[model samples]
Target: MKSHSEMKEIATRLKRDIIQLTSANTGHPGGAIGAAEIVAELYFNRLKHDPSNPFWEDRDRFILSNGHICTVLYSAMARSGYFEVEELKTFRKVNSRLQGHPSRHDLPGIETASGPLGQGLSIANGIALSNKLRNNNSKVYCLVGDGELQEGQIWEAAMTSAHYQLDNLVLIINWNDIQIDGHVKDVMNIEPIADKFKSFGWNTIEIDGHNISEIQSALDTFEINNGSPTAIIARTVLGNGVSYMEHEAIWHGKAPSSEEAKQALEEIGTSTFESDLIY
Candidate 1:
């Protein structure tokens, strides 16, 4: 296990990578920025997976339901040794495995190809059920966006997971207020999200998504609570790390220019890449 400070530094470096890579490719940055800390915590501390053996049967699984935000997932995979960190710059480029959204066929760490909204939970349920039937102890984790909750399939999956008592499955909802169209409340409010999950019979917990320790604790707490699927409502800003992007829906699908990327990198602090002379 990495120390708390080491985890923080990894997250910071991944955030810097997200900003720089997205800016280079002009890809999604808002949701990616918001989810950096949570993803970092999971890959660096909570998850039990061997990057060298991507298909390890006993390994835990993670699915990115909100795939547009996968820039951070790709970054985490790279940092975790699933791929070369330098490949981050090829994001969204033609013939590159790292596309605008995640595809399991192309990427070793991605468990599902999930660009469409609201389907990841159902996929996670299937994986969890299979694990249970095989008497396996491996767990499944899925990350969903607040706006994606508007899809009816999410509620169906929620009901099914609880109905079958799939304790091996864990769902993390990125409850950032802003979505592409506008604020989630204005577009389609899923208020009292935690209560909704509770009503569905899920073991629910709410936490500051940016707090690494709290995020880690929530994952640990869920593991000890058996017989019910868990849901973590992680409250976070839309664009968390940058001054101009935080809480702003306009930045949802936009990328920073070269100058803006430089500023964002400075804000995130320097990394080993700075001295590598590889701009």
Candidate 2:
């Protein structure tokens, strides 16, 4: 496993990749940027899989329930060596496999296709249930946006995971507090979030999403002996790595222009070959 400093460095590079890939003024940037560290931690240190063979049996599965921020996932997967990093520049281009949202048909590392909100949890529940019945010890990790909790289906899935005692399942909520419309609190509050998860029979923990060490420790709790699933509500910034976009709702789905992307790369303090060549 990479050290906290190594993971933090990878996080910065992924943030740079996120901005560069979305530079065509398409795709979601705010949430993607905010969730970069969490994604990096999973892909680089926690996830159990071979980029060389994404379908390796016994490999841990990762589901992007809130798929709008897939740019981060794509970046992580690429950097993790699932594919050439150059492919990131094709993101959101016409007929590109790297569409705005994940498509399992085209992407190799993605476990499932996700775009419509609120359905990912149910899908994850089914997968987890299948693994349990098969006596498979493999784990499943899911990333969901804070605003996505408004979906009634998500809670329904949560209840199902707990009812089955799916201890192998983990849900990490990107609690950036902002959705596409506005502040999550103003649009629809999901506050008392951790308490709500606990009430549903889940093991809940809260942590600073950007703190690498804290994230690693919180995730390691998955090894704890427990009968219920776990929920880690990561408190994050909406546009974490960039000054202009941070904490702003309007930037949720807006891509940066060339100049804006340049500024963002400068803000993140890292540069990739793709960063200078992005559309």
Candidate 3:
């Protein structure tokens, strides 16, 4: 098990990878950076996954619902040994397994092909239910964006997850607030998000998305089988580490230029990863 400090180092590396990968090609950088800690903690610390055996039947499933931020997922997957870390350079390139959005067929560890927004939770619900029926003790984790709450289908899936009492399913909402258009409230309010989940019969937990300790604590809380689905409202800054990008909607879908990436990388400092390759 990785210590909290070690997990934090991994998160920092993921953030660096996010900037480098997106800047090399074109991809969403803000949300991926924002979600770095959460993804890092899940893949390196909390999740029961086998990077060597991607199809291990009892492995915990992690579904990236808001697929636009796949830079972080791809980074975590490579760093954790699902594929070669050098493969990150191929992201968004022609015939690359790492695409703008995650495709389960294109990638070994991806649980679903997500891009249409809001559909990930529904798919997660089905997988969770199936696992439960087969008496598989594995859990299914679905990561969604707070902006994605605008889609009516998300709420429908929330109901489905709760109605079935899928204790094995965990929905993690990246509550960064910034979306492509603007702030979530300015665009479409999804406030009282936790209450809505509770109303739908879920066990809700709120935490700082960047706090690896708190993230681990919440996931630990979810492991006790409380007879309800779990929802973690991870409060985060849209562009977390870099000062110039934080809280800005413009960065939501914008990749940094070479100079911008250089500045961002400097601000993020160095990680243990030795790859000199930008991507």
Candidate 4:
């Protein structure tokens, strides 16, 4: 496992990979860029699994519920050695294992195939229940998008998780304000989100998603034996690390041009990921 500083540097570099891969203009980058730190922390220092043995039983399961931002997961998985990092450029391309949305068939580390919103929590809840029934110590970690909370299925899943008392279920919400259409508040407000989760009987926690220490601290805090599901609302900036893209909804599904990618990489303090292909 790498140190926190090392993990953060990887995250910065991962953002460069995400941008470079999505330069073909077919992948989502805004939320993926924002959730870099959270994913990096989990892959580097937290997750209990061996990259050499991706299917080892008793391994913790990470379910990416908001699948549109798969760039974050794929890049993190590559860095974690699930696959080669250079394959990132094949994103959204033909015969690419790193699909636009994650497919369980493509990656050994991916636990579920997800694309339509509001279903990841349900899948995580079921996996948590199964683990508990089997007396397995492995945990089920689910990453949800704040915009996805507007879906009714998520609330249903929340109720089921609370009722089941799935203490091993940990949910992390990427609470970036912008989504595909516009600001989440303007589209369909899910305000008082933390409070909503609390009312649903979850161990709700909030943190600055970009701060690796705080994210690690929050995960450590929830590492205790609590008899309820945990939810971490990660407040983050959309399109983080790029000046022109930060907090912009338009960048949600857009890719950067060579010039824009160069500027983005320069602003993020790294240019080693430089690429030239536009297609």
Candidate 5:
């Protein structure tokens, strides 16, 4: 486990990378920023994978249901040594391995190609069931957007996971309360998300998504849980860490200009990441 201070620094650096990468390619920045801390925590602390062997069988799996926010995942993968961080600059470019959404074919670390929401949970269910059959100790972690809960397939997967008692799977909901169009509540209400999961037989925990300690505690709780799938409702800001972008839908799919990127970087601070590569 990393020290608290080290985790904080990692989160900050990941946040910076998210901003820079999204700005460079004009991809999804809002959700990426919101998910930075949790992504950092998972990649840096909880996940088991060898960068040297990208296809290690014993490695844990991560599925991003809300694939639009893959900018954050790509940033984490780069920093975690799956690939050179310099590749982040090519995000969303034509023929780049890093597309607008994650594709398992192009990226070695990505487990699934997800963009059309609500399918990730089902995919996770399949992987979890396979792990159970193989008696594999590897855990499957899936990240879904709050807006994604509106999908009925998610409920079916939720029920399947519970029925199979896939304790090796962890479902993380990025509860930023904002989506592409507008506020999640305005677009579609998913209140009592925890109760819904509990009804489906999942062990649910809610926490401050941006808090490293809370995130760490949630992972520990998942480890202790048995005979049921785990769900973590991570409350986060829509555009976390960027003053001008927080809770604003405009930044959802918009990229920052060079000048705007400079200003945002100024606010995020550059005195952190071990690597000096910040585009």
Candidate 6:
């Protein structure tokens, strides 16, 4: 397990990579930036995964339900040895495995091909249930955007998880208020998030998503909890590490220009991880 500081540095590097990758091509960056810490803790510290052996049978499954923010996921995957970090430059490039959204067929570590809103949880449910049937003790971690809650399919999956008592599944809600259209509340209020999860018979926990320790503790709690699935409501700022982008709905799907990315990287500071590219 990595120390909290090391994990934090990894998140910082992830934020930097997110900016560089998306700025090179059009892609969503806000939610990806906001969830950097969560992704860091999971890929670098918490998840039971082996990049060398992508199809490890008992490895934990991480489903990016709101796949639009996959820039962070891609960064984490490459940094974690799922692929060469150098390949990151090819993001959204023609015939590159890294598409605008994650594709399980294209990427080695990706658990599923995700893009359309509100389908990830259901996919996770199927995987979790399959694990249960096989008596597999591996956990399933699903990350969903708060804005994706507007989809009726998400709720249906929520009910299914609770009803089936998928204790091995962990659901993380990236509760950053801003979506592509605007603030989530302005688009469609999904407030009282934790309460709603609790009502669905889930064991819910709320925490500051940017806090590495809080993220670690929440995952720890999920591991210990039995008889119900866990839902972590991680409150976060959209575009967390970038001043101009933070909490601004406009940055949700907007790629930073070369100038904007330069500024964002300056604000993010130097990363512990070495980058192949200077920018």
Scored by lDDT, the top model is 3
Give the TM-scores of the predictions, in the order they appear: 0.96, 0.96, 0.98, 0.95, 0.97, 0.98
lDDT of 5 by residue, 75-183 (tens): 8898889999888888899889998999999989889999998999999999988988998889999999998999999999999999999999999999988877899
Q: Which pairs of residues collide in candidate 2?
A: none
Local error of candidate 5 at 199, Å? Answer: 1.1
How many clashes in each structure? 0, 0, 0, 0, 0, 0
Question: How much lDDT does each candidate structure score?
Answer: 0.88, 0.88, 0.92, 0.87, 0.88, 0.91
C-alpha lDDT (0 to 100) for residue 36 of candidate 6:
97
TM-score for candidate 3, residues paired by index: 0.98
**Model 5's TM-score against the true structure:** 0.97
The C-alpha local distance difference test score for the whole of candidate 5 amounts to 0.88
Tens digits of lDDT, candidate 4, 15-122: 887787777646888889999999988888888988889999889989999999998898888777888767777888889888789999887888999989999999
Q: Higher TM-score: candidate 1 or 6?
A: 6
- For model 6, the superposed segments whose C-alpha errors exceed 4 Å read 276-279
The weakest ten consecutive residues by lDDT in model 4 span: 270-279
RMSD of every candidate to native, in Å, equals 1.6, 1.7, 1.0, 2.3, 1.2, 1.0
Clashing pairs in 3: none
Per-residue alpha-carbon lDDT of candidate 3 for residues 1-279, written as tens digits (9 for 90 to 100)? 788778878888999999998898989999999999999989988789999999999999999999999999999999989999899999998899998899899999999999889999999999999998999999999999999999999999999999999999899999999999999999999999999998999999999999988899999999999889999999999879898899999999999999999999999878775454543
Q: Global CA lDDT of candidate 3, please?
A: 0.92
Q: What is the lDDT of residue 235 in candidate 3?
A: 100
Name the better of 1 and 3 by lDDT: 3
User: In model 3, which range of ten residues has the least summed lDDT?
Assistant: 270-279
lDDT of 1 by residue, 210-256 (tens): 89888989999889857999999999987776888888898889999
Q: Where is model 5 poorest over a 10-residue stretch in terms of lDDT?
A: 270-279
Clashing pairs in 1: none
User: Candidate 4, clashing residue pairs?
Assistant: none
